[model samples]
Target chain A: MKILITIQENNVAPRFDLTSEVLIADCRDRQIIGIPRTILMTRPSSEELCGLIIKENISRVVCGGIEESHLQYLVWKKIEVLDAIIGPYLESLEKAKEGTLKTGTILPGAKKIRSMK
Target chain B: MKPVSFATCNNFPVTEILNGVPHGVAILDRDLHVMEMNRFLEVLTGFANADARGVHADFILRSNIGNNEKLFRNVIETEEYLSISGDIISRHHKKIPVHFTVSPLKNESGDPAGLLVFIEDISALQCFDKKRHNMACLDKILGHSPKMQEMFELLPVLAHTDATVLITGETGTGKDMIAEAIHNASKRSRYPFIKVNCGALPESLLESELFGHVRGAFTGAVKDKPGLFRMAQDGTIFLTEIGDLPLTLQVKLLSVLDDMEFFPVGGGKKVRVNVRIIAATHRSLRVLVKKGEFREDLFYRLNVLRLHLPVLREREGDIRLLLDFFMREFSTGLHKSIKGYTPKALNILTAYAYPGNVRELRNIVEYAVNICQGAKIQKEGLPRYLFIPVEEKPPTSADERRDEYSEKAMPALDLPAEIGEKTVSGSWQDVEKEMIVEALKQTGGNRSRSAKILGWGRTTLWRKLNRHGLA
Candidate 1:
């Protein structure tokens, strides 16, 4: 399975539409197989990211607050989307691989990090 | 009424007073932590009083306000009331435009204690403002013709209703824009407005394009794809040149229109969609139906709400209005401050017949703007083609003269008498074929001229030619 997570400053980007960086990882048996690939976009666009998700054959997506339309589109594409998460990127990826990450999950020490601020 | 003193209301609970107010009110400490909040604030932020009691104001508001610390410090230092408008993301990720006001709150010893924050949702007001602006722009975009004015009045009513609309007009008459305007003004404005040109694609690809295909549906089908209909779910799909749709696909389209459900090409599952269909065609579907090229049943299904856009030549009164509109639009875009058109230039433009409609007019304006060096666009700024006079050459050969003569005589002659005199002993089909061949020959194989001579649309003439095996 492949998982894609929109990221910013080593954390999940607060707004999905504004995210310019992404982390794509390969996983098997609920574990990361190798180092995640980082994609740096020239410009942030939700449409472009959605295309990337489909072309990359990403089975799961983890991101912070995403618009309703985008979320519905991903769901229709048969991809598991855990959105509205406020957390560190590494911890969210680990949780996603463990099948424990859920929508709106605020990870431990997230408040102290204050990434968006 | 006399102004009440604060000391008179000192015994009343500040929280009670704040709760009675309509707007969302939150009192933040000097550290920017929530000290107290009204009922409206609790509901607006989706956080209860007890839960938000000690939380940071930023966490509860979740606004895009960047310099929060500086804003709070400035308000405290300045001790002046401040109001600003911005967007705030709600707990459900719904972005809401809000106006916020921060006022300094003082302690008993006259020292700054905290800040009183007022929040008002202005999303509705913002939407109204945007709608008013779009309506004003739409008026200018649609033109000031009487036909267009009628459309403007009917457009809103048509948009409010969820029904299939069939728009008929000549090419370049803004059929696509009408479809878009309807979609933009409809309830599904928030959703995607998908457009597909029915004539642009081939039969094989068009099926899969409108009704998606599963992976391995064909040789090149690498992955499953959702079609335009699915993408336009809960919105609108503007199918331009719908008359060009193949007969085989017309059956499937009819089924989808009737049931609001369709099976993708090579996909077993039925995809139920709630999409409004707005089909446009430059060709006459009624003529196509009479010629048996278009299905009559499908025509009836799509023509539930018909809108026929008038040709530009018919609405000559709007030429000047459209000219000025396009001038201003292109001038501002090109960063050129063109004053206006010269009298000669304007007269030439107004007199010319615009076969390409408003689109051609816009292109002309754009071209003129690009070439014009002076404040006003002169005849010199016009396209070179506009100045090239069409030369009417006389017939050079006996055959050409005879053909030209027949071309002029056909429209005046009685059709049955002409066909009867040409065909002595033959079926009606043979007589019809002879008449078509004669018209085609007289017009020098010009389909449009032959159609006009035969009192038929161009497509109807083409169908007749195909029937006679001449095309």
Candidate 2:
């Protein structure tokens, strides 16, 4: 399975629409298999990201906050998404690899999680 | 005393001071790591200060500037203030317009310490701008024809009054839009503008639907329900296809229009309302009255403020305008980069008679935008039905052949002698083209007057002009 996570520096982007960087990783048996590949965007656009997700055949996505319409579209496309996470990107990636990541998850030492829904 | 250390400076109540500010504020160290942020900033970005501390500023506040890092670096090195305005994606992933200023912060010893950022939400301003633009584009009827111009001028006057309006037009001639425009332009615009299609429901159900029903009014009535007429109090109630109303309901409608009071189904008490009535129908009320189907008294009541809407084929020069409008609308909505229609496609669209009128034109443009792959919509993008040539029917019986021969035997009616002189030795198509050209020249290129002189609709003239390559 291929997983895609929107990132900013070493942390999850605060908002999905503002993300300009993404990490794509290959996972098997609930474990990451290789070094994650990083893709940099020239500009931020939800439509462009949607197109990329379809083109890359990403099965799962991990990100911070995401809009309702984009989430609905991703759900309709049958792609699993864990969003509204506030934490370091590596910690979120590890949680996803372990199949323990969930929506609205705040990492250790982080402040209280605020629901966006 | 020695200069205050950076650790000592961090011990200050930075969060408290920053929180007191109206707008969002953030403090970042030289390494670009977020050291402190205000409560407003935390709520705006959906990131708690505890989680945001030590995180890169780039991760928390995504800037639209292409080289945001370089801009921050320049601000840190030069110690100069920079202000910029752009959009930021919030916790809900909604873009919020914002204005932010970045300035250098100094320590107690007067040495540069860190960068201070101030952000103000400008989403309300952006919303107001968008509303103004939409009001300009969507709140008016679009037409340049003389008949439509007259209606446009009269709409405001009619909207100012509370009289009942009767709008007559063919299907898809924009009667609904006209009614809505009148409502929007009226004093009751802030109130509800309810619409009910009279023809879509049966007589039995329509009564209960228009007028509220009391509990146990019928087999299925369990509770008292307010109707559309009540819902449109002090507003407007647009009754579409009013000609389809049955005789029994017609009497009830007449009473309501006369006294502005009606009793609910199975209710003894009468309910009064102050709703403006706007009735529209494609059928002729006079013919229905002649057939003993429509109430004559009700007809006269509705006929007090009559508005006759012209068919699409009669409204010259508006097809292209509507086409361009719908094309741009659909292209933006579908995220396509469709520039325009190809020459051949445009010619075909211009020549085809829109039996469904503007609504059909909008639907066709939407479909074309979806299927069009190139920058311009081509002939292949059009619906298959548009490309199919209409087959001509052959004469079936002896009477038809004789009638056809007689029709061809007679000289063209009302043809100018000059056109006859020029097309005497030409084929039928040539003669037809010459006659059209003569009519156009006589009318000084006024298509509407030329069409009237040629005894044809405006769209027919447009089609012929394209066919003869004279347009």
lDDT of 1 by residue, B345-464 (tens): 786677665656777778888999988877999765776444332334543332343354335321121124433244422555765686688788988999998887666799998998
Q: Each model's TM-score, in the order given?
A: 0.54, 0.47
Go through the candidates in order and give each one's C-alpha lDDT: 0.79, 0.78
DockQ of every predicted complex: 0.13, 0.14
lDDT of 1 at B56: 55
| Deviation from truth (RMSD, Å), model 1 | 16.6
Query: Which residue pairs does candidate 1 place in steric collision?
Result: none
Residues A27-50 of candidate 1 have per-residue lDDT tens digits of 999989989999998888889999
Cα error, residue B215 of model 2, in Å, equals 1.4
Candidate 1, DockQ score (0 to 1): 0.13
Give the C-alpha miss distance for residue B62 in model 1, angstroms.
5.7
Which tens-of-lDDT digit does each residue in B88-188 have in candidate 2? 66666666678989998777677777788898888888877764443342354678888888888888888889999999976677899899888877878
